[model samples]
Target: MGSISDETVEENADAPTYVPSLPVPNVQELVKEDPLQVPDRYVRDQDDILQVNDMSWLSSEIPIIDLSLLSKGDKEELNKLDLACKEWGFFQVVNHGVAKKVLQDMKDATTEFFELPLEEKNKYAMPPDDIQGYGHAYVVSEDQTLDWSDALILVVYPAQYRKLKFWPSTPKGYKDIIEAYSKGVKDVGVELLRSFSTIMGMDQDALLGLHEELVQALRVNYYPECSRPDQVLGISPHSDTSTITILMQEHDKHGLQIKHNGGWVPVKPIPDALVVNVGDVIEILSNGKYKSIEHRAVTNESKERISYASFLVPRDDVEIEPLDHLVDSQSTQKMYKKVVYGEYLRSSMKRRMEGKAHTQMAKVET
Candidate 1:
């Protein structure tokens, strides 16, 4: 774990000393008030159904890779990455060369942003129509009663137009710092995609070519200390919708969990390491060669948690379907349609807002 510095101090001196105690709304009341109506799907018993301790069977072999030691051009490292992608769908990367200071700065800035007073933070609050912002859960209704968390979701892509209008003005240097970090993460993502291409037995540039104009976003999530950590979840079980997600976690706080084999396993944090995972788009493009694993976040009774997830999505105009080379007369290659990335993203957002399970892609014409 990385050493804690003074930057971890709470940004808002006048902010609530603790998460406010709000009454948990009933399911019917939640549905009536929330536009997302997420709580409607889950049974709202006071029982701690979300808690699970039988994680012994969970995969303990999360791959820890050292990119600097591996030959970037070597076929062996690429092969190893590919195998990890197919089997684990998640891995920890070290020595990937994004400065440790930059990562820490981003984390510090995020914690400070979320610490802002409710009124000040609300200035950049997500619009009722947009499901991204400084709130507990945008897609769900306030009455739905989420466990406990606040997040800042930033959309930085197309370098032109964004489909969803969710951007927050922050402290003086916040934007510049975050944008630089985003660009750095994007470059790393490109490198990983190139490695994936090699593993798929395609030209190194093939995947990069297809993603020349990828749309990317950063989700800065903060899960505050919960009064009833065992009774609820920080984030419900779900799979990511992007091609891939690279996450930087706070030291000492253990909130991230992943479903592997059959149980949930805590992903212990490693200082300066980036947690990389496959997403739904990669599963489709790889024709199921790579799976998108289900994961969730859990709250702690005492310690607050923070995480930064950089999602690499395909450009709105990119055609999403299995690669031609992966298909053959003997292979069942026609599983999904050639839909535009933008359409797929919109559909995913709607499903998420509804608090439904992630939707699988179906074969259909654009």
Candidate 2:
């Protein structure tokens, strides 16, 4: 589908603005209540929660197959991997060859960056315009109330881009460590994309060529130890806007949740495994074959949680429309605008800052 510009709706002009309040409950008080009891506002029914717990049934359903096996050009295995990509946009990748030490260092560096004092964090807080740094939800505008979490965002692609311009100057080694991690993650992202291409029944070089100048970014999220973990969520439900997201989780923190068959499923972290999810772009490219799942994170009662997400997106110059090969007489082609990814990102940021609903914005024209 092509992108479409949003048509302004006057009815929303009178709606009350939502400003999020940080709920600070005493640790002792939280332990008294059910550690998993979400606040009334965030309370999801047992059925919904059970769906999350039912992930085991889908085990062997979603394989954490090794990509290294496919590099040998095994046609049968490659075909299976392709089916997995089309049917399940999510996968657990092991033996993809990212160094364990590097991954650990990346996690440590992220924690160190967020642990810096608030004032130091504020230096890199996203500007009202760019919306690319540490900040509370709805910092620029009030759409939905703020989510309970803090994040450090950096853009790292095209090889010649600037390092995060706004970051804490403390923790002397933070910058160097993060930069190294970013480079490593970028390399991994490229390799994974190549694998995805083969799975899509296309030559690896063909897909890489199409996305030669892809836009890649990293978001380091910190969910502070919450006294009332059940009262609030680390992040609200939303679909990622990139092509794919590769996530690394810190030890002992459980917060990532995924949506499957109309339910939220917790994605328990596996040591040394990177969590991968498809994004809107992939859904478009695959012509409804692969889904861009909706997922969110929930907080923990005692331990603080941290996660690193590497987003791989198309270059700003690339036109985002459904691939022609994905359409046929049996599948009607949907028309979206042929907008540039950069414009879409900028517009989306502006809409978010204005406290406007993301869905209200125009769809990307094909």
Candidate 3:
């Protein structure tokens, strides 16, 4: 299962690039007009939940790894992480070494921003066809099923790409808090990817070297209390398009759910832990050895849950594929076509706008 790269042509360093996609109009504005109830426009008829016949899948637990142990290169811890990557595709980390103050302030910042008056918050409303700023992403069509949440989305990495207008300048120290939190998570993400290289028996720097021009996005999701929690989803069921994602959520509220064996399972919150997920990009990079799990968020009846997700992605111009070293006909087959991040982004926006799984477009046929 390890040597699948020979069959395909050696990858070219230069890949074609495409213009990035625009996002839908800010749906958060709509939320302010009618905050208490789910609007007809946001109500979805299609069931996003995966219905299951066998109830046993709920017993499958999401693994928790200690990042401190991973940093020390402990073989046993690395083995546990490898299993988590191959089996669950998601895990939680305690003692990850990110400052507790940074985590708390980041959460506080998300809450205070959402608590602002709608008019105040709308100053940085996402532009049409743009994915950044405060707005609902993928609300591309009038008929799309809207999520039951408000989000402050912004690009965090490569300082040049950041749009300060949307960064919430009104908060006394919002930008500083966000900057520290973003840097902390990025440090952790890089280490996590390094460990993945070891797990796959590749050069210690194989994956990180391929993705030097790193990109990241900060998605602060606010899931408000819904009168009909059962009738609406906070976010739809879909796999992440990025290479990896690190998430922080409040310990008391549980809204994230992962689809497992045709059933939805809730992700319990653990204090001071970051939830890491292997994304679709990583699946392709590993020749499908690691997978991107389908997950979604459900609404709460009483408490509002705020989740801070830092998406780790490569430059859109970078080419993504199964690394040559990871492929072999024995087990690790090249299951996807080489993908340019810009093209992937455009397709993702189009599919999400139309409410479809965009990641499928990158799959290679046997």
Candidate 4:
């Protein structure tokens, strides 16, 4: 086990004060009333939620990377990847070699599972005070306004930690499809982690070595069609807690939005492409060179959006921080304090649940 660094703080072992109450209502089970009416509970506290319907932003440039070339030792591709990581902080990967059939199967299975009755779906309901199974994530209070989306979360790595109880047995091939999809994602993520290291002027295995016990959690988010898409959020604006996240959205509706330049911009959906983003841990590990963008999901009046996010996280007890080589080689100062992955995650959860700034909670004083 790693010791907590002096620069970090973990009061009461950094456990969250607010524990979530279980058996919460699944948002997808609720009725999506009318095209112009939004439930008061789903209304966001913030007034601005991009009430306009504009596709002009899609015409603007966005990073859509081709991973097949990057894996073949193309220097230009490496440079592009580095730029996208440092500047865009988000990109879409295509031609990644994962079969289109596998992707589709996973999406089909997710849809079928969420489409089940409330009782059948709640069979995998999350335990009280935890956010690991079916239901809306981070529902800590009775009055806490909930997101307009329902999600199924599964931990699918490090065989020992697998909770078979929550694993679904429907759709015949659900388990196999997920296994294959996860393997493909892991292959891509491992390559990207190595690429990230190469771009940082460190040994290729420097960062990869930290993944001896890689933990991957999958969240299948179903953003049901909302009556008033202009007024409510499918998901709130927040950064992910993983080191990296691989996301796949249903091809038809594009609802993912990222904060940029001074406004929220949409990430257009490209068929068979996987969206990747730098997460908070990577920002700390890269010594603030890479960024974790704040992004959210918007609902649509007529279309529903389903997305799968594969989150790659470190073991809770593992030490997560910037590499010695990164700070030394670049002559850059360590801009954040090193903390155990578990503690930092708890702090982040509390901040997100209470509507606070979770991303910058660990910035070190320069």
The predicted structure with the larger lDDT, 1 or 4, is 4
Alpha-carbon RMSD of each model: 8.7, 9.4, 8.4, 7.2
**What is candidate 1's lDDT per residue for 45-82, written digit by digit as tens?**
44334444547345357887766644366667666787
lDDT per residue as tens, model 4, 1-366: 231121122222322222344345556656533445566878875554653334446425668777888777679988998898887789999988889999999988888887777788788776666666677666555676678888887777764555554666665667667778988898888888888778888777766678667788888888888876766788887888888999988777888887666567788888899999998888888888888887788888777789899999888887877867668745677877778887888777654343227755667765
Q: How many residue pairs clash in each candidate?
A: 2, 20, 10, 0
Q: Where does model 4 exceed 4 Å of error?
A: 1-23, 32-37, 46-60, 328-331, 353-356
Instruction: After superposing candidate 3 on the true structure, give the runs of residues whose Cα lies further than 4 Å from its correct spot.
Output: 1-36, 53-60, 330-332, 353-356
User: Could you tell me how far off, in angstroms, the CA of residue 30 lies in candidate 4 after the best superposition?
Assistant: 1.5
Using TM-score as the measure, name the better of candidate 1 and candidate 2: 1
What lDDT does the true structure give each of the candidates? 0.66, 0.62, 0.77, 0.75
Model 3, C-alpha of 317: deviation from truth (Å): 1.2
Clashing pairs in 1: 34-141, 337-363
Candidate 4 lDDT score relative to the true structure: 0.75
By lDDT, the best candidate is: 3
TM-score of 3: 0.88
lDDT tens readout by residue for model 3, 1-366:
321121232222342222233344344454556657677756766444435332334534789898889988999999999999888888998888899999999888778888888788888777664667777776656667678877888887876666665677656678878888999999999889889889988867777788767788889998877767777888887888888999997988888887666677777889899999988789888888888888788888776789999999888778988878788778666788999877787778665532226867778877
Q: By how many angstroms RMSD does model 4 differ from the true structure? A: 7.2
